[model samples]
Structure formats: C-alpha cells, structure tokens
Target: MKQSLLAARYFNTTAEEAMDGLIASATPRQYLISVQDGTSLRVRIWSEIGLEEAQMGELLDWLRGVQGDIRSIQSGSTNAHDHASVVEKWVAERHGIADLFLEQLDPTTSSKADMEPELSLGVLGGRTVMISTNTLMFSRLQEGVFGLSIAQRGSYLIEQLRRA
Candidate 1:
C-alpha cells in the first residue's frame, strides 16, 4: 500500500482562501453530505489515496458529479449514516480513501466563530493542506506543517478514516 498522509498543518489564511485551495485540490470521486437537525454540514470526499488534483474544468465536473450523487441520497440518507452500504462499497474498492484530512475549518474547535466560516467536515487525500488563522495550533512533521506522513499513522486512525 502507498504511504498514509497526515495533514494537520496550519496556514494563516482567510476562510475563503482556505476553501479556494481545498476546492482546487479536491478530486472527489464520490462523497456523502450530512446535516444535523437543520444545521451543521459534514461532507466526506471519496477519492484515490494520493490522488492528484483535477484541472479546473475537471474539478468542476467532479464536483458536479458529487452533487449529483448527493442529490441521489435517500430521504433519510446522510454522510454518517443511510449510506453504510455505499460507503463500504467505495472503501472496499479504494483503500486510498483512508487518507482523510480536514480543510476550511477552525481546528482549534468546530464551534461557529466570529465572521469566519468553517467547513464542519472535510475528508481528502494527497499532500496535506491546512489553512487556519491560529498560530498556537498545528503539529508539524518531517513532511512539513500540514504533512502528517500517512506512512506513520496507527491502524486506528486508518480504520477510523475508513469507517467514517
């Protein structure tokens, strides 16, 4: 298997800038979205483990496909549940999907913040990318600030990423 990734870096950028980078690099083949009550957004992006970013149009198309898949969600489907079978199916075919990372979020915590926006949940692969305003946070490694070297993560993290 390829190396696992650990992207817990912190970049001092605005939320919008963070999203821009995340969107540009994301190449989600399949994804699930879930909400609690009427609020809270969580999205789990499924893709190849070390997947490369698609070109602009390709990324846009890929996003459209994800949206299309999301629309197909059953009446009670969500990113966490209602898609257990589907999640299992995808993960089985793509072990690289285990490389889960967060983006466009306030890692200090998930609570809603002052003017800044946060992406409740984000799952991604490839090189680590993290954008944040807090300087006190971030655990760097040999790879870099956001680079967590999946090759070193424990089985628990990998299993948890797959399970989620």
Candidate 2:
C-alpha cells in the first residue's frame, strides 16, 4: 500500500521552528514546502512521493512520539479526494443524498463564504475536493485562515489517529 502525508498538525512552536523539524525528519527525500499563518498554530504545506503503509505508520509514530512538539490536529490520509468523498458519502447516507444536495444549494445556509470572503482551498488528485472554512469536518481542513494552506482543528485529534 502507498500513503502520502496528508495532515493538519499543530505545533507548539513557530512556523519556522516547526518547519525545521519537518525538514529534519524528511531529510534525503526532497519534499516541497509552504508555510502560512494559522488561527492558533502555524500552518505548513508540502508534497512528496507516497510512502509504503508500514513506512507511513513509522513516520507518523516518530512525529507524534519523539517529535513531541507536533500535534495531529485532524484525520489525514494518503489521498484527500478519497477522504473527502468518504466524509461526503457518510453524510449523504445519514441525511439522504437529495437533502444533502439541497442543503448545499440553499443560500441562507451558512458556509465558508459567509465567514471569509477571500479564501479558496482545493486539492487535485483523481478528482477535486473543495475545502470550505465552515465547521464541517472536511471544511474545517482549511478553517480560520485566509491563505491556502490546509489544516484542521480539534484538540489532540492528530494524536489519536497517529496516521496520515
């Protein structure tokens, strides 16, 4: 199995300091990096080739254990599209697909647009997952930030999952 580092982890340090830790951990393999302001914690973004299932597990473990400065903020996955679809499907199954679609179309319904007028977040793989700033699980991936870095909010949510 293959997996990517899809996460919104919270660090108790500054963005620069947290990035230094990430760089140290991902050494020898050159992964792209990006940084931005966060609501309570700093946000960083990066991309690299996927890792094997076991390798991904090991890496996340090290990050949560030895790398005590980092905290997993939300559930992450090797693929964003798949995770978002799963979240959507879970919602649809419970609420009915037609009701879900109607809720999305309802303008009075609160959304990310109502809160921040200048934020656009999306991920592209086999498909696109548009991230909103609202409080939904998937939307919370890009909450409380005007920039493009994807992150999540929830106390110690990352530590619980221990995988990304």
Candidate 3:
C-alpha cells in the first residue's frame, strides 16, 4: 500500500511550468521532470521516481493502476500516452512477447557514434520490462542524474533478454 509520487502530469506545458506544478502537488519530493516538446499537447510536467521501498511485484501493480491505459497517463510508462492501446492489449491478451522491444529514435541521434540514450527498468505484471528513449524524452523513473547505473544494467539486461 506504499507508493511514491512518480509523476505529476500536465499535458501541454513547458518543463519549468511542470516543475512549478510538481512543487505545488508534491513538495519536497525531488523529481526528474520531462516535457514533451513542440506545439502539440505535451506533458507540461511529467515526473518519475526510482528505487522506492516497495515490494517487487507492487511496482508493476502500481503501474497498472496509474497507466492501465492512455487515460491514466499520469505516470508509469512512456507508453502511457500514444502507445497505451497497444500496450494494454499486449498486457491483457498476453500477446507476442517478441514484439515488445521498441524505441523512438531522436533524429539528432539517428547518426551518431554515441547518442543521447535513456533507459528505464520496471516490473510489469510481475515481469521485468525495459524501455529505451532519448535522454531528452520521458523515462520510467525520475533518474536524469542516475542514468549511468541504469544504462549499464539496462544494456546487460537487454542483451540477456535478447539471448533468452
């Protein structure tokens, strides 16, 4: 029954404005915020947390509660938005596990030796789920400063899962 304030969502707001809202909603809790850029309806402020003191399976259950679908894009997966339906169907019907690995490559990094990559790790329906994104985009956890360890482990994990 314990959950952390992982995200404070406000569609179509700037990063600074999102921070202000986050401060108002959940003060004193340090949050890594991301704003979906451009003129479209963006997350004026979306946040996340990592390594909360919760049971292993609880995190996935919590994600389901908040991001069971697109309407619950308050937090959890980046798929909480546009990809909600696909993710929902996948989770509900237990469809092809081989189709889960996907990422949106930022055009800037489309041709680079080392790109701005972001990785997020979490449990989904008691399963270990991993996602990759650009560093400027959203993440599963509020871990901007802590990306190093997550990236290292994420790489290894993806490799292992691929082999499996």
The candidate maximizing lDDT is: 1
* TM-scores for every candidate against the unseen true structure: 0.24, 0.18, 0.22
TM-score of model 2 vs. true structure: 0.18
Q: Could you give candidate 2's per-residue lDDT for residues 1-164 as a string of tens digits?
A: 01111222222122233234434443222222221332121112222344445643433342233112111213343243333333332222121111110011122337533522221222222111233233222222222221112344332121112146
RMSD of 1: 13.8
The parts of candidate 1 lying over 4 Å away from their true place are 1-54, 74-82, 88-123, 127-164
lDDT of each: 0.31, 0.26, 0.26
lDDT of candidate 3 over 19-67, digit per residue (tens): 3443344322222223244421111111232224342134334334433
Q: At residue 117, what lDDT does model 2 achieve?
A: 20
Q: By TM-score, who's the top model here?
A: 1
Per-residue lDDT for 86 in model 2? 39
Candidates ranked, most accurate by TM-score first:
1, 3, 2
- lDDT for position 146 in model 3: 12
Give me the displacement of residue 150 in model 2, in angstroms. 24
Per-candidate clashes come to: 5, 1, 3
